[model samples]
Target: MSQHESRWSLAHTGNRILLAVIAGALIACLCGGTDLPVATQLVILLGVGGVTYALVTLLHRTRR
Candidate 1:
């Protein structure tokens, strides 16, 4: 594989793990009986995390 592709693959793996952890945290908070307001905040966090993950992945792919 080319140098750039290898770098991107590493980055993508790390980002995927980070995103998964964020999602897991959201789920855990909801399951823990957090109140509506706090649960809503966790939902927002999930959304932002998803978007950021997507953007970074796209940018990495485009650089190849």
Candidate 2:
């Protein structure tokens, strides 16, 4: 595929991964993540996911 298409694909994959990770984490929390460690881990997961998603999106946009 072309470079642009490749970038789009990468961004799409990143977005899917981000969503899946967040969803799974939330579900876990609902199931039994009622501890300080779980809460802290959730915060870290969210922060990392957010940054990675943003970076992937930015990369796609800048390449365009």
Candidate 3:
């Protein structure tokens, strides 16, 4: 129905942001050269995710 189409067309910002964060962390993990300890890996993911979220936010702001 047109109602469903309208709802689907309106993107939910929060989900998009979470996806961006996860994608950033995943890309970082895949591209990292060094084999770090589990704890270090967690830290790396956190750092990359934070940076990615910031960049995404900046980009989204600029696009608006």
Compare the candidates by lDDT and give the number of the best one: 3
Each candidate's TM vs. the true structure? Answer: 0.52, 0.52, 0.58
Worst 10 residues of 3 by lDDT: 1-10
Checking candidate 3 for backbone clashes, the offending pairs are none
RMSD of 2: 5.9
TM-score leader: 3
Prediction RMSDs, each to the true structure: 5.2, 5.9, 4.6
lDDT of each: 0.65, 0.64, 0.66
lDDT of 3 by residue, 1-64 (tens): 4434233221456755686678767866775767767677777777777776677667767765
Give the residue spans of candidate 2 off by over 4 A: 1-8, 11-36
In candidate 2, what are the lDDT values of residues 1-64, reduced to their tens digit? 6555554365577655666577656655664645657667667667666665676667768986
Instruction: Tell me model 1's lDDT, rounded to 2 decimals.
Output: 0.65
Which ranges of candidate 3 are over 4 A from the true structure?
A: 1-13, 28-34
Sequence-dependent TM-score of model 3: 0.58
- Distance from true location, Cα of 56 in model 3, Å: 0.6
Worst 10 residues of 1 by lDDT: 1-10
